[model samples]
Target: MYSVVFQEICSRYGKTYSWDLKSLVMGKKALEAAQIVIDVLQLPMSKEELVEESQRKLQELFPTAELMPENSPEQEWGDFWAERTGCAVPENEGLELLPEAALGTRDVFKPAAFTLPDDAGRVYSSLPAPLSRSPPHAVQCLVFEDAPNGVEAALTAGMQVVMVPDENLSRDLTTKATVVLSSLQDLQPELFGLPAYE
Candidate 1:
């Protein structure tokens, strides 16, 4: 029934959610599509509610769900713009993060995220200032690819590292270079301040 659900979503609100489901457009496009779906479908609900309701109904029909959404911060980025340095946040509030390999750009390893928020808002992906050098630091980038390992190393090296797991996933984390590794075992124990795991 996955096909059925996809078809329904496309046929019913495809034009509306096109920005959200499509792999191309970013920022305001997604926000608009989401808002359109909410309105046309009369889904008068908060961002969280909309996501939850869609998940519930979709699940009722298809036992095997396929949506792999990224992490979303509860922070209210209300009325934000995406023009300046840190304007990559609100526009990307509820965007989805997909797997790479065949879906992402070769310029980056992590999956790419799309959005529909305005072109002049903060999307959380672009942090402001010196901390923005996340991708340059060796251990920082490592922690990004392998968080637990990176975190442990940062701890052992006496280097302070604060991770903002919120707003993480495709665009933001890729920009931050802080995507969390899926399995702890995938990271070396040396990454955890101890000998490599055997």
Candidate 2:
């Protein structure tokens, strides 16, 4: 019974190992079934020191081959889905209930009070940054004007900050954080060795 069950498992998964099947499923009955196949098939080692040792012996006895590469991400998410949308599935913010409700709220407080330095202003990028695969640490500091990001400082130190200009600047400016990329194209994988899709 165990040997027959093992044969069925092997037929379905296209793998040639009791240990792999054992890892996928758990139980003594499954182990017993694998043993039966090992015993009847005269597998090289039913009791090797390690599974790799067992695999080596099995290869010698059976001349192992595979119909497909095991770790192909291509096999996981077909070509179209993999190539489509660069695989950055936009997260649903789940703000449907109060989507625009927060806009006119009284609780969303602005800075209570603040003053800008008379001599303070923002620095300008005379040219755009080119694409590079440098690691994030390569940049001692990053700057952006008003795109959604983290760790921003208000422009108040006499052009000591980097500015990213966009047409969609709101009347009430969030002049705190610095934007990294001037456009979405700047976020390409070729710039980071993580090119979207494959």
Candidate 3:
């Protein structure tokens, strides 16, 4: 979806994006990605305009595009956690889902608040009640984030954050992370006290 819209925009400007550049912007927030594209192309468009145009294009394309995977991998990633970590996941606020579906045999939490500094509890509390048996201390947590805002959120909560940034993101924007990596594939979970991948 984004690639198609971005390619269309780039075509208008006689610009082309490499896959690496596309990967970089893929991790950014919508407007942030749009701004990066605008800067890269030196497009005479505001970030808001770029976002609006992209969204309009997405709306037009999504219904017709062969979007859904015919067969999603049978929960390989989620199941791995389910086996080793008891599978408690967080449900962000404002998304619609039933309580049972939201927090069931599979643990899921929705933070009480999204504010910074004091948000550590919210992050912890988002874990299903049972899995939150450990005391709530930010350092005990490790956050993996892609966007600067998410990094800020984890930092404000006093957790160590591992940033997997878009390759094209500014180096300066990633300095605050405890560590930065090109991809989650490079993550060493044991360094953060999690069980190492098998």
Cα error, residue 47 of model 2, in Å, equals 70
Cα TM-score per model: 0.26, 0.18, 0.50
Per-residue alpha-carbon lDDT of model 2 for 1-198, expressed as tens digits?
A: 222334444554354544434322222222343464555445544533233443334434332223234346423333333343222111111112232333223222222112121232311111112212233331322223332211122222221223343444432333543334354333333333343634
| Backbone clashes, each candidate | 24, 6, 1
Candidate 3 residue-wise lDDT at 160: 80
Regions more than 4 Å wrong, model 2: 1-94, 97-165, 168-179, 196-198
Cα-based lDDT for every prediction: 0.34, 0.31, 0.58
Taking all chains together, the TM-score of candidate 3 against the true structure is 0.50
Off by more than 4 A, model 1: 1-7, 16-53, 65-173, 177-186
Question: What ranking emerges by lDDT with the best candidate at the front?
Answer: 3, 1, 2
Q: Measured by C-alpha RMSD in angstroms, how accurate is candidate 2?
A: 25.5
